[model samples]
Target: MKRQLHSCALAALTLLSTLPAGAQHAEPVPSEQRVTVQGMKNASAWFKAESQHFVVYSDTSRASVFQLLNNLERLDYLLRLYTSAYGKPQPLESKLTLTFHKRPGALAQFADTPPRDAVGLYSSCSAGVQGAGVLLAPITELANAELSKAPVND
Candidate 1:
């Protein structure tokens, strides 16, 4: 009887070891749809800001994008300064269109800060366009506000 019991216990232990110890779980894969918005002139980088998150898109290399995203908090401060200097606070509902362009081998253009007139709308020719680094914050803030106010189901 003792021998039979010992063998049964060993078999049970082996069976348990062969089977999964517990429920298996897998981590969710991250989303792949990365949005890119191009900056003006020498900047020539795509900027995507979603829910306070920002990324720079570069066809040449990803380093630029990673740099921008990592320094977003500082960039937000710069944006507020630009908006205060050039733009008036309007209703959040105001829709503004922005265009991005790249200047070859001219990263200095971004540092120089193109005149407001040079960054105008594609169609209007008179409307001013601000740098992506400058405009992303207010737009993101307003978007977040709108989202929070939206109705939710329990």
Candidate 2:
């Protein structure tokens, strides 16, 4: 009787271990995914790091310039509203600048410019917002929209 009990316990343990090996956990869905925007001409966009300042850049086309500026304003409002709702009032520190470049390589050349300390501020503020757990969904949605607007490469 003692031997049979020990064997049963061992078998149960073995079965439990084997079950996990064959039955995998479901894969997690990604929270953020890339979004591609078509018909964006002369427009290349990226986020620049400046503490609490979100600067978007494009190759200085009239339409692209306006679109980026408008987007920044909207983003600013969203950030403010979300942060306030969390009982943390943190304002954006950086302004959006639109520089016009006459040619193709202009945006790349501008990208090489040394980043300012504002990047740190932006990161810290973002961390605080995330820590408060108030900005994730809206920010994720915004990021997805921005990415979808980006050009897709083959």
What is candidate 1's local distance difference test score? Answer: 0.43
Candidate 2 matches the true fold with a TM-score of 0.27
Top of the candidates by TM-score:
1
In Å, residue 129's CA in model 1 sits off its true spot by: 2.9
Clashes of each: 2, 14
Off by over 4 Å in 1: 1-21, 34-57, 60-63, 69-76, 79-88, 93-154
lDDT of 2 by residue, 37-72 (tens): 587554343322222343433223334444444555
Give residue 146's error in model 1 in angstroms.
Answer: 36
- Best candidate per lDDT, number? 1
lDDT of each residue in 48-144, candidate 1, tens digit only = 4322433333332234344444445555656777888687755542222322234332333454654443422222234533333222211222233
Q: Locate the minimum summed-lDDT window of 10 residues in model 2.
A: 130-139
Off by over 4 Å in 2: 1-59, 86-94, 98-154
On the 0 to 100 scale, the lDDT of residue 24 in model 1 is 72
